[model samples]
Target: MDEVEKNKTVEKDMKKLVNKSWFRYWLSAEMSNSYERLQSLSFCYSIIPVLKKLYPNKEEFGEAVKRHLNFFNTEPTWGSPILGIAIAMEEEKAKTKQIPGEAITSLKTGLMGPLAGIGDTIDWGTLKTIIYGIAVTFASSGNILGAFIPLVFTCLTFIIGRYLTNFGYTVGKDSVKSILQQGWIKELIFGTSILGLFMMGALTSNFVKIITPLSFEIAKGQTLVIQEILDSIVPGLLPLCAVFGIYYFLKKGKVNYGVLAIGIVAICLVASFVGVL
Candidate 1:
């Protein structure tokens, strides 16, 4: 190989070499114990789709898949789709003679909106509402189902993601390009995302309830239970509304998360002090 080809070969080899370290870091499974690992791309699940191209053998693929699966204990909401994008990047790299700066830049830029849209839709909206509904159901029955909440979702993530990897890897480069280029597919992704958001909202509206005590002074002596008060707030609606309102304000004014968080804390504290929580 020419010197240029030699450098290219070396770069590919270095990427491969780094995968070993990345796999080891992921296998550590020390979430919340060492966030540095997560921050260091150890928690990056997006590397999976690309790995099939980089490593073709079943042994390498299986090992990489297992390592990726075992490596992170945190929620894989964004991680899964991020892995999808990584696969797309690798496919793009393989298709081009040289990595077009514009291509890479476009992918990066395009991912931002999709990532935010998907992350907020699935993680904050669909998954949380579903799991919360499940947990609250079990917990209300005094079964401590809330404790198993994270485990249940983790299993779910693995199951869904296994398919995503299978499909993305099997289809490889051309498929990814087609998925990206097709307007209908993009619409489908957004449409499903919207449906997920709506379903989550509807579920949360019906299932996620908060209770508190209240009294009707003008009428004959009446004790209004917390759930009843929630009915007045549009039938189990206020908490979600409150959160969305806060989120809206934060978005509208460009408020920092810290400030919003502090506002939330203050609201909680005040509510607690007043026995309204």
Candidate 2:
């Protein structure tokens, strides 16, 4: 009787161990690795079916699920690192006791705010306006090769993310001191962000377009038009002035984007009414 009970207990523990998705362990390692990284190749939902095998019961798997289910929360550019760190932590914890999945909900609530701030100001805030600017300039001039710029940028995101994923995983098993000593995360993230800033500056120079409007005033002798006077000031100055005006309103008035969009429509209508579209 005693032997049978012991065997049953062993089987239960073994089954519990088998029930977890071991791969997610890598995610936990990666998220802790750097402020920015990417690792996911497919939607996290796709992994759920396979993940079922890793947990024998719902309660035992909650923490892992909560942490690993970051598909919608993360951008492709940062997926790998986020998933890797989540997975890595879960696996480490599994060695002793199972973590309740709901714990992830609380953890995420805390981490997401900081991550979002870092991601936006560094990645999208500065990078998007810059790189896309270059892309448009190249594309607009009918330069067929210029279309490749954004595509290349997209591919570059994947490459950077994959590299970070690998780096994080390799270091996951190590102590924090050892990992920090390598300066791998700092070097990669800082170096990349700096490069991103540089790219933004270069792109800004290429992409911004301004067109000015000129008016003509017909002289009493019908020899002069307003376009003659406007041309004397500067070509395209009107358009540049309009842009600055709108920017000032947006900043000073604290107008929301929606309000600004509505204002644009209203201005367009007024311009069309006056034959100034």
Candidate 3:
């Protein structure tokens, strides 16, 4: 092969070398969780193949393995970029002998927290919420296909995670740092937050039900109907108020979800019994 073609072939071969590592990571990202070490064991396990390949010498391989075994935990899917970058760093260290093992450990430790936050916000908070909300609508209408929506989304997540793994390996850490420096990640989080709020508002209006049978006697000849007044002022004011009240308390971070649910049921039962709702 010519020089250019030969270089391309070598690059492709190197990428293939890491595929086994990536696949292992994808399969066991959360399976071997531990309270103390968290995902460190799984993380080390995932990259063991690549580390073995890179550090063929027994002493070097042992040090590389030990470095990855340090406390490491992050969102499995979204945090995948860190794995890709780690692989790149490992490869560099093996080839150049300049990048220290401690640097690799520090890179992982530093990135995990930030990436975990972003992953939790986007994947768990926004994407899953939106998907499940749509699925719930289909489910409530008795569509059996709704049951498979989450499964489909889970598959999609795997595809996304795989793509990110390859992307991180291909692009390396400089690109990731550039993306973060440009504030794109923050904008993504904000946009998703707004979309999540919109979805929640839509769900609340569609599902939450509250009405009152309250009236006030202004005079013997004329009674002031509270429901009519509320309707005139706002069509679904009671439901809105109920949803906002619950949201406020939850945001305060002092309420347990189970307690809130039971309290709501009790309050609704009392209100209905009193003929006020």
Best by lDDT: 3
Backbone clash numbers for all candidates listed = 3, 33, 0
The segments of candidate 2 whose C-alpha lies over 4 angstroms from its true place after superposition are 1-76, 98-103, 167-277
lDDT to native, each model:
0.52, 0.48, 0.79
Model 2 lDDT per residue over 28-86, tens place: 33343321123222324423543454455787566445455442234434434443344
- In angstroms, give how far residue 229 of model 3 lies from its true place: 54
lDDT of 2 at 19: 28
lDDT of 3 by residue, 1-277 (tens): 8999997986777677667777788788888886447799999999887888788899999999999987788898888888888888787668757566755666676667667778899889988998899899999999997898888668867887788888888776454345445745445445545544565576578888888989888998899989999999999999999988988988898997678888999999999998989
- The lDDT of model 1 is 0.52
lDDT of 1 by residue, 6-98 (tens): 979855663453343334333432342342133224433445545666557787566545444321223344434334444544545455523
RMSD of 3: 12.8
What lDDT score goes with residue 77 in model 3?
83
